[model samples]
Target: MGHVILVTGGARSGKSSHAEARVAALPGERVYIATARPEDDEMRARIAHHIARRGPGWLTLEEPFDLAGALDRTDGRGPRLVDCLTLWLANLMFADRDWSPEADLLIAALARQNSPVVLVSNEVGMGIVPENALARAFRDAQGWLNQRVAAMANEVEFVVAGLPLRLK
Candidate 1:
């Protein structure tokens, strides 16, 4: 099994940067499994910014869904960085696709990986309760997903103010 690291934090907390560095430290070509979709101008700009920050030496794969399949395909190639799970979850939810089965598949794939994987996820449960039902539901689902991944991860880090605090 590969070394699985989960990097989580609030928005703008530098989770993606830290996760990228973790994957960059490993040997072989760096694979970036980007989950974000360029749905609008703002999102496209954000994606561009990430691409610019990463600079080069990355084989980027845009997989808004089927993350498990992406991992399986990239497994033996190199260290992969899944840049943010929150957007993946949102994509599933907004598209009316059942996310539990996909998440389960991801966990199974992670267990069988042969190369290192660094995953970025947002810590959304730290703030006050959301007002809308959909927002609350998303929060609950994100918390559950984070817990499950962290439990299976070999190492977990919570980033705050660009600092990664090891949790496991």
Candidate 2:
């Protein structure tokens, strides 16, 4: 059986950095599945920073909305680091696709894979509910996604101020 590790926290909480460090420690090639889209200059710069941090040795796969497809492509080789599931959820939500099915499929696939997976996500539920409908829906969907991933994950860690707290 494989190991599923979920690293979650709020914005700039170092969840992605923590996930990268954990995956880098593992043996074999590191596959980074980045979900963030470079919709603007700021986002592009953010993506570049993450890429630079991961260095040039890691293989990067940009799957903005097809996480299950990306997981299947991993082929159980090495540790797969999925940087931020929240963006994937947002992409799906924006596309008008209900994200539950995809989330379930991805979790099930992760559970059965032979390679270790380090999934990063945001802990958005700690904040007050959003007044806008879309934002609220996104928050709810993200919460559900986090719960599903956490349930299947062998280890769950929450990062705060660059510190990791294991929850499972």
Candidate 3:
């Protein structure tokens, strides 16, 4: 029913910038679905920076969790950008929420959307395996989430050194 584009990359690899640019070129007011929760000073600064980076044309919706619920109610007439699914995953993990149900809801919502959606995520499985069990579990969950989203996307791109390599 809608177009979903998946953008994945390593940290600081320009995934968000590319996703933003892709959605900004489309018509209608951009709806930015921010999933980051500012817990500390650095994180707060990061959130502020992200807000400042976006123009006044964007209607920012801060949904650290309940992303599926937000998407279900959001107007699908405009191109929406969900900046970084990785943090959303982390939030779910830390909150002891069932990731599968939330992920399923997100996929369902995406399938019903009437406009384009650019999903940003980190390619975490590419790096060395984690030493801790929790970290390993998070990585595994992230991989699963990315795989699921990629399968639903009309286009999938891997960003490296600020360059996008189309994967689908």
TM-score of each: 0.98, 0.97, 0.96
The 10 consecutive residues of candidate 1 with the worst lDDT sum are: 123-132
* lDDT of each residue in 20-136, candidate 2, tens digit only: 999999998899998999999999999998988888879889999878778878956798999879989988889999898888888778867888889999988877778999999
For model 2, name the residue pairs that clash: none
Give the per-residue lDDT digits (tens) of candidate 3, residues 74-145.
Answer: 756589999879999999999999898999999998998888889999988877888999999999999999
Best by TM-score: 1
lDDT of each: 0.94, 0.89, 0.89
- Model 3 residue 92 lDDT score: 92
RMSD of 2: 0.9
Tens-place lDDT per residue, model 1, 1-168, is 999999999999988888988888899989999999998999999999999999989999999999999999998999999988999999999998888888999999999999999999998987889898989999999999999999999999999999999999
Q: Which candidate would rank higher by lDDT, 1 or 2?
A: 1
**Sort by lDDT, top down from the best:** 1, 3, 2
Candidate 2's TM-score: 0.97
Q: What is the lDDT of candidate 3?
A: 0.89
